[model samples]
Target: MKSRSPLVNRITIVVCAVVLTSIVSMATTLAVSKSIEGNATAINLAGALRMGAFRLLAQAAGPGDNHNTAEPNISSFLDKYEASLFDRLITRAIPRTADHPLTNQYRAITSYWETTLRPGLENHPQGSPVSVEMHANTETYVDSVNQLVSMLERRTEARIGLLHLIQIISLAFSILIIVALFVDLRNRVLKPLRKLVSIAGAVGEQDFSQKANMTGSDELAQLGSAFDQMSSELALTYYELEERARSKTEELEKSHAALQLLHTASRNLFANHDLCSGAVPMLQELEELLGIGPIRLYLHDKEAAEPVEVVTTASTDRPFYCRDHHCNACLVSPEDYDELPIEDNDGRRLLLPIRTPGKLLGTLEVWYPAETGLSDTARRLLEILSDQLATAIFLERQITEEQQLTLAEERTVIARELHDSLAQSLSYLKMQVARLRRLNIEGDQKSAHESILEELSTGLNSAYRQLRELLATFRLKLDTPDLATAMRKTIEEFSTRLGKPVGLNYNLPPQALSPNEEIHTLQIIREGLANAVKHADATEVIVEILFESPQVKAKIRDNGKGLPVGEQPVNHYGLVIMQDRARTLGGQIVVKNRDSGGVEVILTFVPKSRHLIPTEAPST
Candidate 1:
């Protein structure tokens, strides 16, 4: 909670200041003491030299010469001489022994007296050149005093100069220390702290989007780490909440779509319509609603000795049978219903039984991988879909039976009309022609004539048109053709009608296209040509058909003025009709503009029987 930086800084400053002050005080005191000692030493040396020279001159001049004043002069000179000698020795030796500034001055004065005064006094009688010698000593003393004073002044100046230099150095060092302290605070502590504060402020504002670039393994880095932890936690929490909300929304959507499909399927099945046609649509809606990969159907046989023995499938050409004779469901009872995993090179398979109150249909087998196994909810939905599909199948069988009865009645009526109209007319015409020939033989042309000829021609044209219509109907009623040839024929018809350069190319192996595929291909080709004529101003057309092992394909190309892809025209029912036909046959239609200034319509045909392998009938 408490920081030590400020306190540490304050103590450092105080210590530095105290050390600098002490150094300055010591330097100044030493300088002043040296200056005072130099000045005092110069003055004392000059005074001692003066006294010794005066006393020595008096001593040499007295003693029985100038008899009356001799004794008194001699006594006074001797006393002065003794006192000067004492003063001279003490000033010179004592100062030198003490090692004071006066020692140098005393030695200089002693040399001056000995060189000029002492030699002159010893060379002549005591009183012989006393005044000259005394004058010389006095001059020498004055010169020596001037020189000593100058030396003392120079010494004092040097000491003061040293003191000034020391003070300057101390002040400079103190200022440098203070500047360094300020710089350290700015670079190391204060700047980093400010950076941390800015980063924290940004984070507090919910801006975990940006990060701090703090470096080093310092305390600031630790703070940066803490900030990172908080930011990461907040970001993770927000992401988790967002994901949960999204998941719930998606689940709700799926549930609503599933319920809607159930409602629609129920309505369609109960209606008195073609249930076979409706069942496919219902299954497709269910597939889209529940995101089913693929779907199939297996039905129980009502006309067989046993339902399982003669099971049927929604696939027109396929008969249903159990997966090997001894499959896991072979002896499975209703209460013991379970799923068995079947693995093959293609993928995994799941075999589920279709059961009602007291009857069992052929098992509904699905092929999917292990990872994408049916969930319980999905299985339940499938169960519902399967039940609904069975009811629809039952209704469709009923519709088929009724349609068969109605078709038989219509055939009988058409046969009757053919017999009544054409046969009776032919019979009457024969008799009339027979009588006309007899008249011609007898030369009677007035009663016979153009009436018979015109009537015959009219009836013949009518008969021809009726025959063409009948042939068209019969072609439609016959079994579905081989898809490859059917597609080619349709394309050729379109080319003739359009009077354009058109061609059909098929890519299938011989006899590979199945019955359902043949019909679908025919429908697709017919629709594609109709589309080309209406939408594409095509001059050259090409129809390509391919029947591979797994799927059938028809690609129609035309060099024409291309239309915008996927932009369905408002009144364009032709393309919609094509798409509807494809959907009915469980196929897809894709239209796009080809590179060579043309439109290409692709029809992909997946035969329902490919996924539904037929079961061989049992040997009687």
Candidate 2:
């Protein structure tokens, strides 16, 4: 499915709002119906209690009793005891009609009780002789009331069922509408918007020739119109901006060119493969640029080692030397060397510290022969250039450190592989050779003995070749197709040691891997397969290699009991070693379980370094 555009997203939000409103409105209706049902149930329960009370009274009385009452006594008695009696009756039989369905039937029963039974109960006292007729008369009314209550319950259930059906239908319809809307918006709008966006992006890259032909006058059309207009205006403004920009750009370019020269000159000062050869040329350039009569560079040291005087020039006009006390400031803090009368004869001198990251690398001092002095820009620029030199020095140190790390990791891997596979095999061969030698020494010249000796010789040669090849694994100075071959042989040895069969399945074309990517791929594959064989308990493993331009993929799969959820293999040293190695190669690892069984581990490495490849070439 295509992603929704901003306009489609807005439409979706609006539709969602309408759907939510409908849902809330339905909820309100259901809530109101429930409230009304509660009230009706309460009324029904109250009526049931009143009617039940009257029926009980009538049952206690005999037939032929006068159950009717006169107006005054009934009215007065009702006013006093009707409410209290009703409460007592309900509190005993049915306290509330809430959640009960026979509400209407109970209401009718209560109405009949108020008009007929309550009046009689008020007018006649207990133990009245007129009770028999009252009992007979109310018996028929009781049967009718029971039937009515049953009907009311059935009707209540039906109504509730209907409401539930409406709710389900409402939800189903709303969901269907949303799904259809999304499909329509995706195909009709989102896909087209994406095409327009791509064209717009190209236009932004200053390809003003690119245009979007919006066929219809929809919102998308307006967007295309706005985009086209922007491109046209951008083209017109490009020339004006370019002219003004060129002036400023020229200034910027000039500044950049000057900075480049400064960087190059400063780099030459310390960029010695050997410091001894580069030092003199640095001082010569400095003297020529600054017009100083005499210059000297002193390297700062925390411990006393005779400071190497890198460069020195004799003053033609006057001799200037660092007084004994001035050397103290230069040694401890070159930044505070301003206290010294470092000025030249005409009051123009310059002192700069080549410092990086706290420690001082060195200091440069120039003695002017005339009144002219270095400007502020020149001073600031000199300090900046000094910093660049210091950084370069630091970088050179790091390159050495990194090379050592790479060599060390390579050595470790080679040593471990040899120790685990080739060494053990060689030891077995030695044991066989020793046994054959003992047999020959004993003078057992039987046919079997001769055959064994010949076999041992062949085995020794094979072991020799294998050991030499195993040692060659460490000699990988650059990533190549040969590295892949070495890695495959290593995996075979690993599988043999583990008593499992492993196969290498690849379709990598020739010259498909970069030097760095090739090394990273070898390492990741080595580690991944080793992990799977050791931990996954698989019988057979298949390794797949696919090379697509700009990306190369390697995957290892085994048909073993899959890894447990959230489980990772234990790495005693640290699991991060593999992860870090991958990151260094600008790659990542993904491990997952196949649906059938076992584990799958994949690694992808891409070159992100500009220094490693030609800039104009597309990624391979």
Candidate 3:
């Protein structure tokens, strides 16, 4: 890295170089002027004096008449001689200074002019004829004048040579300065700027790896460093973005896979109500999906409080167990459930909670024997799977309870029908038989016999009607999937049956229901809805069902005439049936006229599982 000048300094150097060159040239001109200052003027004056001397000599030789008319003559030799001697040019040429070489000669000439030459010229030079003495004096004066002119001419020629030499040196200096400035401009400014431009072009082409060679103290050098830094940072950012994008793509793939698993899991869970039958296979898939070691699920079926179940994907022996083997304490104890992820056995295992909003259904314990704990994507998938498993367990329990409830409801219907129809008919027939037994061969025998026949006919018809109704009730199976879907179907059915629209508001979480709560709820809602449609003559009917954690509430409202005044709802078979269903659910039903021109049927029940759904800690 060679040293370099700053831009300001470099510019200053070039300016100074040019300025110095100009000063040198100006100084050279001044030196030349000083060297030959008066030489040229003095030479001209000397030459004029010499020519006057020759002209005076010529005039003395006789241009007095005819020849003098052709050439000009020095008619007054003294006047001409004095004027040339006293002229500024002649004075300047001959010096009287002590250091001057011409001082004596100049003084001698002054003496000659004042004393000898002036006297001689004044006496005879006024149109005088030529003489030997005059001629000799003129020639001597002319010889002196020639000597002075020759010396002046010689000194002026020397000065001219000096001027030429000075000019040559100044020109060389100026050329050298300009060439130096040009080289400096190229090195300091142009080359570095080109480097920066090249780096910029590389970066514009998305080649972030290019860097400028930074090696000076100049502005261009600093700019090159800046370009290098910019490229470096861009390269880093580009790689970072690539890494992030790669990780994001991998995460998306994991999410897609997790979604596929959840979809299939939900489908299978819904298709089969027996939980453990699918649980083992699902746990196996989950273990493989996560690439973790074997996994186990601990379930607490609140219904069968005595026994806890642990389902495992791998058939390996259980490494650990609780002290209470029969009760399976580890599966049920609150301490065994971990809501937050925890690493065990040197961070190779995790225990996650299987929970819904209403209850803590189970615990999922997983391990990775060959590696550390699961990655974030794996953990998120596991959490989602835990939720699915919780719901699956809930659905399994609800299905079981629903099946039992349906059987029990059928039995209760049978008992109620038998009590309402067959028992009464049999009782009436027994009464008729007793009357027959008690009667003797009396006058009213025909009347007694006709009465007995009528009783028998009446009892048989009653039995037949009850049988038809019981058959109708038992012959149909529920067509819809879940309770909400069933309720929606029921409402739609009533809407069509009543020839108008029926509004339904149903909100129920998929959860386990009490012994007969599901069937009872559905039956009670149906009964209330039917009454609102057929009996109330409703123009609008709204059926609303909401299930809180432990309680189910339903309402059937109609914007129409309510029950007839002073009518007792207890007497109606539909109302009686609703009441019976509500009672079976451990709930109460109410039928009343609304102040707003309608009748509202309300039912509220705390289904048995409502007790099982852990109360929200008085906080939730």
In order, the Cα lDDT scores of the candidates are 0.57, 0.57, 0.66
Clashes of each: 1, 10, 0
Ranking by TM-score: 3, 1, 2
Please write out the lDDT profile of model 3 over residues 1-620, one tens digit for every residue: 96555888877877887788678777877876775677778777777776776565565555345455665444455476678777876676665586565555556666766776656655655455767876677677767767777767766676677777777877787787788877877887787778788888998888987777778877888888888998999889988999889977876786777678777877887786545445556666655565664577776543333223446555322212111123221132234323212344343667788888878877888776434456788888888888888888777666765776677678668767776777677667757666765666557577777676666655555554434444433332443223655666677788998999899876543333533465567777776776676568788999877654446678989988887888664324567667877787788999888999889999987655324222221110
Q: Using lDDT as the measure, what is the rank order of every candidate, best first?
A: 3, 2, 1
- The C-alpha TM-scores of every prediction are 0.36, 0.26, 0.49
What's the TM for model 2? 0.26
Please report how far candidate 1 places residue 419 from its true position, in Å: 52
Candidate 3: regions farther than 4 A off? 1-5, 34-38, 48-79, 92-159, 271-352, 364-380, 400-620
Candidate 2: the clashing residue pairs are: 41-97, 42-97, 44-103, 62-132, 63-132, 63-133, 64-133, 65-130, 65-133, 66-130
CA shift at 20, candidate 2, in angstroms? 6.0
Identify the candidate with maximal lDDT: 3
lDDT of 2 by residue, 1-50 (tens): 97766666767776886678588758856764763454355437644644
Error of 1 at 456 (Å): 64
Q: Is candidate 1 or 3 superior in lDDT?
A: 3
Winner on TM-score between 1 and 3 is 3
Q: Regarding TM-score, does 2 or 3 come out ahead?
A: 3
